[model samples]
Target: MARIRVLTALKIKRNLKPGMYADGLGLYLKVRPGNSKSWIFRYRTGGKLRDMGLGPFHTVSLAEAREKAEVCRVMRLKGLDPLNERLKEQQAKTIEAIETITFEKCAEGYIAAHKAGWKNGKHADQWTATLQTYVYPVFKDKPVAAIDDTLVLKVLQPIWRDKTETASRLRGRIERILDWARVMKYRAGENPARWKGHLDHLLPKRSKVAAIVHHPALPIDETPGFFQILRQEATVVARAFEFCILNATRTNEAMGMRWDEYDEQAQLWTVPGVRMKAGRDHRVPLAQRSQRILAQMQEIRTGQFVFPGGVQERPLSSMAFLMLLRRLERKDITAHGFRSTFRDWAAERTDFSNEVVEMALAHTISNKVEAAYRRGDLFDKRRQLAEAWAAFCAGTAPSKP
Candidate 1:
């Protein structure tokens, strides 16, 4: 007869390494790297050896592991495989976890698991923000399995028409979160938040219901006049704005510009894919005015960013342009609208092809066939267009029609 209780609680704590230590009767303590320990039941069923995990050392005590091993020994005597029985027990626990998990809990888990793969920090933040602001208010503590179509509709209808774009994005985000829940086994049925074949029948199509509102832009003729005043402001943000307009780039792109990205001799500014909306590198051909702006910025250059913010060692705040606009009493127009202004001027004044103009603005072509056919960035044509645009913004008549 084998002696029972061969292992004591003190001995379990003393033996710590990266191999299995046997207690007796096929019960072993597996110690791994980082001092992590767990209990395992090692047995031979038929001709194969099977190792079944009990629980972690911190959770399952020596006494408990012995009791579980005794149970497994009895099952083996009855001609039952302990490994198969352990899997069945795990399945039961997984079912319990699925039933008890709340929608918010599942959402948090999903974000934590996937946010690292997102393009930028802002996108990850947007995922959490939308879910918390809109979805959480409705299903704060509800189990994901209990979420239904009516509850989802209740979250969307209030903002569906008034804040159409935000509401649409929110709906899509909720659908993704619910889909994740189903994949995680927290929910079993078809996603209630799904737009196609489900919510499509309930709410009006977004395109039909939501009114499209373009950002307010300066008229083609007014750009020169606005810049004349803007040039005299003598502020870092003002110069940043001028550089942004001259390059036909976004506010964040201009604010986040770095000195190393500029090639003085080549006269090009390469915006990295991380900072771009399309997640691809964009090469901006610097016009004379753009280079001049860089020359002016060189005198005050202090940190990594070409235009440093009010705080130390950070890029300029995105709101700097908007605040500057407000101070200039141009609340009607947005900094982003300058891109549209450039587009309008290019279409109205220049003989340049739409492709060249769109490329200058770094606009992604929505038509797949058109995008596939377009290979080059048309750098030379865009350079000509940029120089002409700079001239127009500086109150000079374009040399080309």
Candidate 2:
């Protein structure tokens, strides 16, 4: 063999230009102008010249570089391209691995895919707020695949007991995102956020958790008088609040109501699947008074929403309805509590069945066995019930069936 040309440390320090140099035995030095030095392997693959960076000199010593280079030489001799082989290995590790994806990246993708399908625009805002508050801080920098049960529990346990309803929803949302990650191969195995049989055994049931404080509601008898005063209160927000009570829907659902959702001909207003609380479509039988309110709203329907805010293309704020209630000197009542008023009134003052009343208010009936057996929405019976409710709210005697 010819005399060996070894690379001494002194020679590496002297030639510190940013390039690679052959130092016999397939080892080479990649020198940078800043005196930073790394090692590379020079080899021929199919009569082609190629270079592969091994690592920094500090991390990979001269001996180690030579050992790695010998492996590359053998691979080349066996007709394998070292660079192509290394790339293939890297690609394999990246596929379907949570270690490669960040929480922020997955969150953005989750929001994009599901935002439009949300029941209301505020649903999207709520999802973003929960992630920002709980999930983002913990996993923003972490790879999605690395998130485990312990990590998920850390974000959930703090609020799970105190804010059970919201916490339960947040848990479901978290499971959805992790499921998306798994489907995309950014994560693997069963979802860490699963609840039904998995997390259920670990955490207390949501119903067992302490209830959150809500604004106390006015008695049912006081609602019609409250509505009368609310009608005279001249503001888009006040009118929207009155409509919300009359329709017995949620504040956001009413304020976010669109002109297209109305059917003046059919005397119905159908909240689309994306906007209903149950994520199912709801049909509201439009009473004559509700139709009159819609007609009045048409005069101000300059935009898509019935109650457009001052800002362009924005719906009225949730607080706006509450403020109107306050201005009417009914601070004791809540916008959501009006639904309770309607439920009480329907139960006490009418002959409508519990299912009809529950479905009318878009409340999910919890009796799974009963729900599975019952296919019909009892729309006709509910229409008759709604007519009776309308008469009661309008200060008229109940209509004869």
Candidate 3:
């Protein structure tokens, strides 16, 4: 009941045509247009066909190709698309010759590999600064494979108590680098930087770390006063901030809003999954004030962004909204905390259920069991909630002290 293996080294050598199907999922050892022999591994992921180029046949042997196909098959079984993780195969080839791969090298490679996906250079800059300042001093040149949990804790322990947020992000970055190294065949075994089961036992819970006060939400009653103040200013930054408050969108989401994403007829703003924090395309129901802000931005729109900055082809600076808040004399509250403010208003002032409010905020449900049972199809209700919140903020006067 087993299919005979017909495509061997001799067969590949003789019949190097452009269309030679070999192994599982349409794995083909074929010649490209110019007779450059290549192997392409095709597999189905999420009901879609994906072709993964294995390598040139001249360099890749039959046994090696089979080995890679097996790895992809295993990944597919675990619900991971090997196409996304193509670096694994590419790195494995060059990595075996590298005996002493350093953590710094891996860290740099990780940043280089992923920095393109980040919205701006600030994220890469932060990664570089943290690694150079905190991690490099400890074990930057050390062989990444030899890095143990003890080493990870050593880097984190000094700042864990004093600089909780930085330390937390540092630990996660270390973990990701180690993971990347492992996948690239530079290291092996359990990830020492992982926090869930391993490092959680080593360090105090993040929630218990009280040194850094995270985004402090403005009081629900004070939001209207703040919104009115923001509206008084005629600057584009102020208009962007007003739009943010009215829609309850994140700072990046608000700043990164594209002209093409807004549909006037539908009164909808379709935020591509790449731009969203939840990593899913979100359909935001634009309120009257939000629509008005869009219309205002259209009058002075430059490039693709709804809120373009001084720099060409760039949105507003990452700190633009923060600086706006500081000018408004509200440095105590963050732009991000507006989501919490909106949640508070929804729960206390209105009869809207928590689910609708959460949908409006684009908060992905964490509980798998709860998520599986509940269908997140509360768009119409969220529209009503958005309109109500807009009316309360724009129409009503600030609450009397």
Candidate 4:
């Protein structure tokens, strides 16, 4: 019989020659010039013979190499190309590894890749915040490839109606991330967060599901007393809060107000279209008290924002007014509800036109016909109404402060 398994483990380890040594059954040891030893199976397929490397000698011992060589021998005997079979095995493993990528990893990748293109810097932060608050708690660690409609619904159903806008945004964001995963070959199939055809059937339309929520407003008759109490505090937030109520602006608009947006000469604060909810520039006519508050802020103006937060160079927190309410033992009310109170007062207490009052609140006119016809913001009339509002809050006749 021809020599088979002739090279012992000790001889294989000790031999440092740069040549191939046959060990029967087409299995041979390849010793490179650098003293690296590996196992190879010389086989004939079609008309030519070729060498296929099994593995390195250090990791695959003499016995292991023989076993792999025997398998390749059997494959060739069965008329299969061993090299092609190994390539297929490798590709399958690579796809399996890619499939193991997690949803959190994909989300982070998506945010990092697209945040630069977003106009607002806070957009990235909001994406991360919402994912952390909602999605991560549910299935962030699960494989991205495994995510489906059932898992997606679990994340949105609880907050769907309670936080309609946020839930809607989150669904869209998840859809985008899943799409990204598909493009990267991490996942495949229809996106579970897709709304129109897939999720629409499972869930109600956002508008139909979301009930219009009215913030708890203070009684119109008691605003003057509440204003008097708010005036007693000398904090920067208190002054900013007072300015907000005087203007009848939204919480975000007031809290994000910058000194640069104000024009002292005209007694007007022009909120840029970027800051306005309607995406149009809004001119707010500052009243006498509001002007006084501006003067006070100008004295201590440390940063760009009119209402500087505790942190340097940052605006006040959204919760500042709510916290202020808690401190004054008025937890029954909300800062946003003050806008409703202003609306009620304008209707019941003042003779101001609906157009002027709505303009003061910077509310988007839902009536398309009326909005089209109304051109001017009625700044002069709004100024008079603002002064009247201040007087009512002060429990004094409307006067120039």
Candidate 5:
């Protein structure tokens, strides 16, 4: 039997306790111990009992609860669970809505998934360091969905002028993480880090930023004295630096030098395309001094790399050369500046063409027309240049050779 529907005016004065009072039409008043009353509907779907809350007593009057109950009763009769259907609808709405996933979380997930694909562990560390230093402090707590152009500008604008190269990489990384978040349903919309039509106008071109000034090379006359001082240092790093200068190669290329890359018979060091900066195989014509250094390194070689670090298996760190230079009190000259020194000596002292000099340094000349026509490596000209430079370092000339 169903009870008569009591008007709110009577129920408000009566102060009902925690229990359900049938109010007819499948609607009932559920009162709490605190005397708060809410409207609920009791019904069955596929022999299963279900209770659905309609509204609070104060919000929905007895008349309104009755109307809502009739709708639920109809829904129940149609083979639907009113409670289950309501929950499903809520979940669907949640899926469509954008929510905040912090930048820190997104970056962590990104690094964990993609670190293995990086060329080296240092590459992974570099990516993490940039985000930790520049991006995380600005957007760590902020939801990825809430980040906009204004927030992104705050991160980039400070270093955009001074550290353009690093800032450029940071911008690309930010865009990648946001794109990943969107694909994972954490956020959705256009990527704010995009530079094409958006940030291009707002910021100066990265190329236009002031070029980083490195320590200039010592004058050509100072080469003999510098080489003499470098030779006095007995560390493997000093030997490596000497080898780098003799070959005119970058520090990274030298650090990762492998014994297998050398061919004693061919008298050449073949740096693989993966290790070369231009991503092409580079053949360095071995000078007399370079050959001597390799022969000396063979006594210590226990693994793949010629200049293995203290750990035995790994290559010497890129900083190893710089630290050695600092110890010699010649920190004014950079390890890379030796290439400039070699170039200066070649241009001022030798009769070799610019192509020969550039080839010796393993630099890619960008003149497309000339590059297309000039396929030969000028190996004979380079051999003469390398021998001449080695002679200059040894304080002798070709007349003596």
Candidate 6:
């Protein structure tokens, strides 16, 4: 037997004090704080309680709310989920609005929304470039809703193996655009460009398709010889490259170093959070050789930057180190590969702890538990390590502690 309806139209009109008023058969008229009112349908499904919203009391009358509740009750009796069914009906209505937006329009909208927050300016250009080059030719004019798995496969399949890296990046961009489309109600259903569980079955893994290639690095023993040649060059780029190798800093860090970042008395160069790859401030201890470079840099320093380009105010171009390498006729090795050279030298020849070496390179600690306990930066220990690295590059023995 069903319970009698506890709430009437008159009762709902009079009582408005922030509480649930039952209408029986899983229908409820709830009053919220500040005298707001709404209808809810509560039911148990698969041993879990679920509450689905009906229309608000001001819009839906008692009889109308009861009618919606009855439909939901009937759905449960037939072993279907009414809440999920309601969503499907709502989604169908949303698709009616989505059909007008095309894939290209949606992709442009997504890029526009995200461009400001992206770190690199080239990233914004790449988003439009990749889509224009590959994806736009196929689906540019088509409605986002019309992009199915088959259509997406048609766009990706030809380049999947031959241009594996580009194809992988394209697939990710397509998936992100499709996801944004779904959220904006310009599309519906599962993302057709999704890789895991969907496209994984269709295409081979990117690793299997693309050959692995590492950046060329100088052999550990060969660094001192290279350093000797590097020291002889009078160019700012040469000095920057030598600073990069000594501190195990990236090219950007070396080139972007400014006058304010250095503490002359403390002998530390602090890379601010904004400039660092991990978005954390990294303190690089100045070795005797690095300090000597800084002293020479100060004598000729034109503007704010330690390594000025042709213009005094601006830092060196990002390609400066690579061009320097090319000029030296050592085109086989990249500027970034110097970090690996530092790591190799540390592992093979030094007695310093691995943490100190990694810290010198400003690599993020991967072990969470170990990192948590390491509250101190071990700057003194790292100073010793940096000094040793400098001595090694100078073709001298590290002084015994």
The candidate that achieves the highest lDDT relative to the unseen native structure: 4
For residues 185-260, write the lDDT of model 2, one tens digit per residue: 7888988899987899889987678655765776877666766776777778877877787788987789889999
Evaluate model 6: give its TM-score.
Answer: 0.72
Residues 179-292, model 4: lDDT tens digits: 999999899889999999899999889889887668999998899999999999999999999999999988778889998899999989998877777878889998889999
User: Residue 327's C-alpha lDDT in candidate 3?
Assistant: 88
Candidate 1 structure lDDT: 0.89
Better of 1 and 4 by TM-score: 1
TM-score on alpha carbons, each prediction = 0.79, 0.70, 0.71, 0.62, 0.67, 0.72
Could you give the C-alpha RMSD of every candidate to the true structure, in order shown?
5.8, 8.1, 13.9, 7.1, 10.3, 9.0
Worst 10 residues of 2 by lDDT: 1-10
lDDT for every model? 0.89, 0.81, 0.84, 0.90, 0.83, 0.89
lDDT of 3: 0.84
Error of 4 at 391 (Å): 3.0
The TM-score that candidate 5 achieves is 0.67
What candidate 3 gets wrong by more than 4 Å, as runs, is 1-97, 397-401
Q: For residue 193, what is the lDDT in candidate 3? A: 95
> Per-residue lDDT of 242-296 in model 1, one digit per residue for the tens?
9999988988889999999999999999999888888899999999989988998
- Which residue pairs in model 5 clash with each other? none
> Model 3: per-residue lDDT, tens digit, 170-251?
9999999999999988888999999989999999987788545657999887777777778899998998888888889999
Cα lDDT of model 6 by residue, 207-281, tens digit: 898896777999987888998999999988899889988999888888889999999899999998767888799
- Best-to-worst order by TM-score is 1, 6, 3, 2, 5, 4
> What lDDT score is found at residue 350 in candidate 1?
80
Tell me how candidate 2 scores on lDDT. Answer: 0.81
- Compute the lDDT for candidate 4: 0.90
Measured with C-alpha atoms, the lDDT of residue 323 in candidate 6 is 86
- Ranking of candidates on lDDT, top first: 4, 1, 6, 3, 5, 2
Candidate 1, position 88, lDDT: 91
